[model samples]
Target: MDDLVTLWPSAREASEAEDVPRRVMITGSEGYIGSVLVAKLLDGGFDVVGLDTGYYRAGWLYNDGKDRPRLLARDVRSLCAEDFEGIDAVVHLAELSNDPLGAHDVRNTYEINHRASVAIACNAKLSGVRRFVYTSSCSVYGAAGDDMVNEESTPRPQTAYARCKTLVERDLMRLADVDFSPTFLRNATAFGVSPRMRFDIVLNNLAGLAWTTRRIAMTSDGRPWRPIVHVEDICDAIQATLNAPRGAVAGEIFNVGTDSNNYRVSEIADAVAQVFPESEITFGDTAGDNRSYRVSFEKIRRHLPGFRCAWDVHRGARQLRALFEHVGLTEEMFLAPPYTRLRELRRLVESRQIDSDFRWRCHDFS
Candidate 1:
């Protein structure tokens, strides 16, 4: 918060246009998903303002350009009403992204993901912000078995990450009314390439391992079903939620991604194998792994006509393959701490770059 003093103005002083707002404030704007979404919003004719703590700033695979939106280096927990003064919409993407990262500290998961998110929404609503697009995860569907779960499905959250998503969704729905329309987008497992590329995801990890080690090995039996959407499609969905009319999106929870994009773990491994023909794959035991869900994405499809998923697993795998080849990716880089969120956060804390509360020790850390 102190670092933001010199870099960013107070939200009241920051607004260039007060009457009309083509302005959007995106939290975690430098993240794997946020980095891509910021560019999309900019291209879509919005005056974008980014807020991020730069937790994953070290996770660079390559530079797509040094260019970034006007960003505030601040944590979401510290954000006040002054931060949302002229913001038209707030796309909340900051959180302990996945299950393992959420598990690292359950209290932090509830604190940052659930409690902090609700605080931001309340502040946004209090500040007269029109919309709040929350990036919830499909992992909340936990173990829905072979049945395709929809927005109304009973969520059996298996991890702290999933539970926090459910909590935020429930609380945000309660906040929605005539003034503030909060849209909860439960995104499927995200894939595809970005500047801050992550190898912890199923598709990206499998493809990167194949490219670097020429081998794909699964710890689980590869039997659990997962719905996946490309990173760009997710950005499109966020943009759609941002631009939609108030009445249409008010208190709505839409599952992002496509119904056709669902695949088992083994199928993703097979797709990776196809992309890298020389790679070998090994399937492990599936007895104990209970996480499996096939999500129904019809709600988002029907609601947001402008949104469409362009890339499938095969296309995304090929994209990752091209990226790995271009960067000369190696086994060491594949297993590096930066590319994985939990590993990188652990490294940052252990090295004293950030404290246990996730606040940076110095501006140099950003």
Candidate 2:
């Protein structure tokens, strides 16, 4: 009874300590999801410190007036334990983000996504950072047929990008302890507005094509299933995980999306076409892009009641159309490197802005 009374204030103090403004460090905070998430965290009163190699800073679609967080323009591979000092949590979003970029150089994908990510998490754990929120992807469930897969389902990651996600998730789990809580948010395909927007994604690409070219089309048959969530809602999920009780999120894996948001590529094209009446729809098998998965988001809903997907495909399409109309999106801009991750990375490589390892190359002006 005396011991219980003595421990009560310490426990209460710890809980109250967490209630104060948290200092969160987000890697890849200049990219698509990272940009929006930084703003959302700041608006939610988190003290945000952003770190990025600035691979896509020139890829701005528009000015949203969301100021960049206190930033460190450094590569994730170079992150040391000292970087985690004074940080309450670390949101790991840095990577070779998609299939095309992964396909471009499989070795680099494994290096940055798999190896570097695990290294960062290990450092965070060593530095005593309590919460590590990994922005994993449903792409890890590559080619999961008609059945809806959940956190327990066997991951069948097909591409190098997806394979790295599974590897990182597995590696991070090994570091989880009472003092270090790691949460893997296997996010569905992300869409909707962001200051650093990506049109390489299905819905965003189709919307861009429809608005700029007046045509909605696909290089594949458009049958692949993809569950999507809005960028803001993804931010919501991250924030929830950051503030969630340690017991609730410790080493937990949650599919970050709504079940109903899953759609076939053709369905997404149709939604975009509906938004732009003048746009014609086209489909063909230019390539065998067989990746498909229907994800179950029930775990997050049940575990983290505060996390909910607030955007659907139709709503996201409408939002994109409005943004495109407001900006007077041109075909040239739509097809530019700024809107596509793979293209932008390619451009950076060609110009020697970044080297083969995707590290920024220092200019030799002297």
Question: All candidates' lDDT scores?
Answer: 0.87, 0.87
Candidate 2 global CA lDDT score = 0.87
In the range 278-312, model 2's lDDT, one tens digit per residue, is 99999979265679899899888887776778899
lDDT of 2 at 301: 84
lDDT for 122 (candidate 2): 89
Model 1 alpha-carbon miss at residue 219, Å: 2.0
Flag regions of model 2 displaced more than 4 Å: 1-15, 18-21, 364-366
Worst 10 residues of 1 by lDDT: 1-10
Q: Residue 45 in candidate 1 has what lDDT?
A: 73
lDDT of 1: 0.87
TM-score for each model: 0.92, 0.94
lDDT (C-alpha) at residue 153 in model 2: 97
Q: Once superposed on the true structure, which residue ranges of model 1 sit more than 4 Å away at CA?
A: 1-21, 287-289, 363-366
